[model samples]
Target: MSKKALYIRHKAQPGKREEVKRIWEKYARAYIEDADGQIAYVYGFDDTDPDAIVAYQFYDGEAGKEDFVKQPWYPDYERETAALLAGPSEFRTITPQWIKGGAA
Candidate 1:
């Protein structure tokens, strides 16, 4: 079964949104190009609320995600961005029984 992750981020701080995006961009290459099971990724900010950004990322399976997260760069990315973020971020794992998009 294929698995996916839905990540929602809300930036409570007024001036930190740009920084948040920069961090994501810094790690984008590694996460998308090199990470295991990473099928696709889409991210954007709310028009009415720029402080809010939603990311939809799909992985091949649970094991792939686990392996990806364990990569050295993953922790480095997390640690560097931890202070730039606001409150707790949310992560939802989903089993994509059927996906309409093309495969990665």
Candidate 2:
């Protein structure tokens, strides 16, 4: 299957969800907003898990994701995020064969 979307579920260390959100807002938000081929990007806290942050991104194509790690702010964002995370994130690749509207 061809993948055009990504979902990341990350659980922050207890009481560190705010730090994780700040890191994304300070770094990743601008990059995603300006990135080429990015169709949509959104993130928020999990309804049942106060320590969890979930992110969903829709790309125009697979090539759209190539620059994520290459961005200048990526290192700082990654380091800060990793420090606050309870553990490794869960990545879910999606095949967008039935997309209908913009992401929330």
lDDT of 2 by residue, 1-104 (tens): 14388899999999999989999999988888898777788898999999999999888766767678788888999999999998999998787767666432
Q: Which residue runs of candidate 1 sit more than 4 Å off their true CA positions?
A: 10-12, 101-104
Question: In order, what lDDT does every prediction score?
Answer: 0.69, 0.85
Q: List the residue pairs that clash in candidate 2.
A: none
Best by the lDDT measure: 2
Instruction: Determine which window of 10 residues in candidate 1 has minimal summed lDDT.
Output: 4-13
What digit string (tens of lDDT, one per residue) describes model 1 on residues 33-55?
A: 77657777777786887566677
Off by over 4 Å in 2: 1-3, 101-104
Model 2 misses residue 69 by how many Å?
1.6
Model 1, C-alpha of 33: deviation from truth (Å)? 2.1
